[model samples]
Structures are given as C-alpha cells and as structure tokens.
Target chain A: AQSVTQPDIHITVSEGASLELRCNYSYGATPYLFWYVQSPGQGLQLLLKYFSGDTLVQGIKGFEAEFKRSQSSFNLRKPSVHWSDAAEYFCAVGGAYGNKLVFGAGTILRVKS
Target chain B: EAGVAQSPRYKIIEKRQSVAFWCNPISGHATLYWYQQILGQGPKLLIQFQNNGVVDDSQLPKDRFSAERLKGVDSTLKIQPAKLEDSAVYLCASSLDGGQGQETQYFGPGTRLLVL
Candidate 1:
C-alpha cells in the first residue's frame, strides 16, 4: 500500500517570507504525487500534481513542488507567502491508474504578520 | 462551470441514529468519489463510482455505511447507527474521467457531521 508522510504537523511563516512543506512517500514503483490545500469551511483545492516528465511542477496560487525520485520526496514550496496562504495542506500519493489517493495527516500553515 | 455540489453543509446526529449526505457531480463528469476526513487528519476514500456502477469500495465500513449513485450523476451516502468516531467531514468530488493516469478531481465544500 502507498502511504504519505508529512513531517511537519504545523508551520508558521511571516508574510512575504518563503515557505516549504516537506512530504515523503513509500511506494514500490514510481507514484503520482499531488498537493492540496483546504481553507476554513472550504473544500480541498488542488495545488499541483506530478505524474511524469518534469521533476518540477507548478501549481495555482503561486506554489510549486519538486519530485525527487532518489529521496522519495515531493515537497511544496513558494517564494513568498501571503496571509491568505494560511490553510491546511495535504500531500497525497496515487497509483498509475484508478486514482485512489493515499494522503498524509496534513500540515496546518499559519501566516504571521 | 459550477463545481461539485453537496447538501446540508452540516449535520448533527446522535449515536445509533442515521444520517445521509447528497452530492451532485459536475456536469459530464464520469467519476465521483466520497471521502471521510477526521479532525487533524487527511481525507480517506470511502467509496468511488464510475457512472452508475461501483468502481472501488474496499475501504468502506460496509456494516454501517452505504452509498449509491443511481443515475450516474447524483449520489447519496448513508450511515446507520452512527458512532462517535464517525464525526468528520464528508467530501464529494468528481472528475472528467477516471481509471486514467492523470485525472484532476474537483471537490465540493463538504458536509460536516457531528455524531454525539
């Protein structure tokens, strides 16, 4: 079974500061990876996805993630974060097909002013 | 285009009671999914539907949980004799097509259920 691990349970960053959330996964073969964000009282929104080809994948809301095969990691990053960026973020791993995603416990992001 | 729609927004039920959630997938979407998310945890797949047929429901707690998509568009999930641990957010999502390698799923706002 594929499983994802997010080391940080919570992260706090000042406005305009750079941000990075660590994610690691365990799968026998190469796996599809995704990043999702959920705000208070809102549904989960896709931040980005990595399937094949490029190791770096760009997403909405000025976020990006790089897939490192050697380390089994796909960490999300942003050059600068705004207050609105504060939310719970999830990292997930999926199979090559059928779209059953296994997700991490999630990391709550706090933006400090 | 409008996103996936889920009703009731929130639901409160007592233990041993029953509750149901409704979901309408995006137009033309062929795959729909239901997930349960506990507090401080990521969402877990409860069931999946491809059109009007079940695709995967291996993780669903069959004894107390049931779901159906009769028309291949709208879906309903029901929990009988709910437990306190059932308190969670139920999210519904739809995708253009499933069983493919790279389908992006759109999510609904979710229904928050509190079992007392």
Candidate 2:
C-alpha cells in the first residue's frame, strides 16, 4: 500500500531561522505529492502540490517543496521561520487521477523567539 | 469562492450514543471527502463521493459509520453507538473533480468529537 512518512516528530527553530521538513513516500509508481499545514484546533490547509513537470513546486506562505524521485522524498523548505509558522505539517501521496490521499503522521514545528 | 462548510464545531457524546455531522461542499465542486483526524495523526480518508455517487468507502468502518451525499452537494456522516475510540476531528473537503489536474481540495474547519 502507498504510504507517506514524516521522519521528524517535532522541530524547534528560532524566529527568522531557516526551516526544512522532511517527507518520504513508498509507492509502486510515481505519486502526486502535497504539503499541508494545520494550526492548533483547526483543519489542514494545502501549502503546495507536485503532480508533474517541475520537480520543485512553489506554495503559499513562502513555502516550497522539492520532489526527489530518486530519494522518494518531497521535503518542504522555507528560508526563514516565523512565530506564525508554528504548526503541524503533513505530507500526502496520491495517484495522478485519484482523489484518495495517503498522509504522513505529520511534523510539529515550534518557532521560538 | 466560499469554502466547505460543516456543522457542529464540537460534539461530546458518551459511548453507545449516536451522532451525525453535516457538511456542505463548495458550490459546484464535484468531489467530496470525509476524513477522520486523530489527535496526533494525519487525517484519514473515511469516505468519498463523486457528485452524489459513492466513489470510495473502503477505509470506512461500515459496521458503525455511514455517510451519504444526496443532491450531489451536501453530505452527512453518522455513527451509530459511537465508541470511545471514535474521538477525533472530522474534516470535510471538496474539489472540482478528481480527473482534472487543477483540482485542489479545500477543507472545512472540522468538527471535533469526544466520545466518552
């Protein structure tokens, strides 16, 4: 079965520091990848997605993810972290035309002053 | 465009009780999905609908859970005799269509459920 894994359970960074969240997937075929963020006591919001074409996909809120097929990874990165960026991040894997998405356990980010 | 809408921001019910949640997808969206999100886990797809038709329900626990999307717009998910393990947030998401490459799912605020 297709699955997504986020190795980092928790990450803390000082405000204005760079941030990177790792995501890996296991699937028989190339999968559509997505990154989503969730605030405390709230639903998830899509950050970015990679379907085809470019290996690097840009998303909202100055976030981006690079789809590395060789590594089976689609890690999300931001140049700087803000206090407002403290939230849980999830990575999802889906098929090219399927609506069913398999999401990772999620990584909780903490931005300190 | 208006995002998906869900009712009952929070619900608390004892085990063996019945509960139902409602969701209205974004106008014109052809696909709707219902998910279960545990406290420390990512959302899990429980059921999916494609314009009033059942698209997927493989992951749903049919013995206790049932969902329907009638009129192809609004949906409802019900659990009979809810169990303590059913405590979680229920999320509703909608997209234009699964076949379209531009389809991006929009989620609702979700309804938090606590089963005692």
lDDT of 1 by residue, B28-93 (tens): 999999999999999999999999999899999999999999889999999998999999999999
Taking all chains together, each candidate's TM-score versus the true structure is: 0.99, 0.98
CA shift of A50, model 1, Å = 0.5
Question: Each model's number of backbone clashes?
Answer: 0, 0
Q: Point out where model 2 deviates above 4 Å.
A: B100-102
- The TM-score, computed over Cα atoms with residue i paired to residue i, of candidate 1 is 0.99
Worst 10-residue lDDT window, candidate 2 chain A: A93-102
Candidate 2: clashing residue pairs, number:
0
Lowest summed lDDT window (length 10), candidate 1 chain B: B97-106
Name model 1 segments beyond 4 Å from true.
Answer: none
Cα RMSDs, all models? 0.7, 1.0
Residue A54 in model 2: shift from native, Å? 1.6
Clashing pairs in 2: none
